[model samples]
Target: MTMPQTITVLALDVDGVLTDGKLYIADNGNVMKTFHAHDGLGISLWQKCGFHIVLISGRNENSVTVRANELGIEHVFQNSKNKIADLQSCIQAIGCTTEQVCFVGDDLGDLSIMNHVGYSIAVQNAATEVKTASDWVTSLPGGEGAVREAIEYLMKANGTWDSSVASMMQEHANQ
Candidate 1:
């Protein structure tokens, strides 16, 4: 498995990739999902390095919108029946090519986009076929800091991980 020479966009599938593939529905029909703090920080770090983040989900859940807003992710496509098309639109909107995108997914629905991106990643608990199609698989499961693991791997491969961490440490020291 070879890493992309450059990755400018990080495209993600929301359900199984950001959450643990579990859904909570209230009696009133409100759906809820949990996101990991570690993954949040990892995303922040990725954006701080000047990369873009986009979210594509097959379901239309308000929680996903709320979470994306909290993370300052501007490109969000929910209720997407065709992930590849949404991803292509996102790539165009961001003025980047498919070779500059890395997609992390965990299920069959994510397979199409995974195959279309430059680097495809699957979480530890991903479906067998999804894992087989991926360039890399995270050690952690989804909603368990798996996104963080993928971000660190990409940053390390791009030679930005050490410096980014150092900058964060220096900032903490000053604080």
Candidate 2:
């Protein structure tokens, strides 16, 4: 089997991929979701290394806004019904091909985009149908370390994981 090209852009689905697939509403109709700090730092490092990242979601929530801001994520699309079309536009905006893109998703909404990307990754807790369609399965689940795993895999495939992570680790240790 042939390996996919080094990923230049990462497209992610919000609910399942970033927030463990739970949809909850508080008594006041507010939302709550937990985000992993490690995932944030990993994403920062990945961006510093020149990989572009985009987040796509069918729903909008407060947690997504906060997390995206914290991570310095560039492209974010929410309440999108036609996910595949939005993803195609994103790919074009990045000036990249399907061969240079990696998509991480955990539900059926993400399948079409996954099919078009070079690296299709699913978190361990993803739906069974999603798992079957993915090119790789992560050990971590969403809202845990799945995003981090995806970024690390992309860095590794691009031959920059070690040096980039080493620098980040060193900086953290010194601080």
Best by lDDT: 1
Task: Assess every candidate by TM-score.
Answer: 0.96, 0.92
Across 1-175, the per-residue lDDT of candidate 1 in tens digits comes to: 3365488799988888899989999999998889999999999999999998999888998889888999999999999989998888878888988988999999998888888888999999999999999999999999999999999999998998999999989999999
Ten residues in sequence with the least summed lDDT for candidate 1: 1-10
Candidate 1: C-alpha lDDT: 0.90
Q: Name the lDDT value of residue 103 in candidate 2.
A: 85
lDDT of 2 by residue, 1-175 (tens): 2254477888888887877777777899998877778788778888998888889999888678777888888788889888878878888988988778788999887888888778899998998999999989999999898999888877787788899978978998999
Error of 2 at 84 (Å): 1.4
Off by over 4 Å in 2: 1-5, 173-175
For candidate 2, the 10 contiguous residues with the lowest summed lDDT are: 1-10
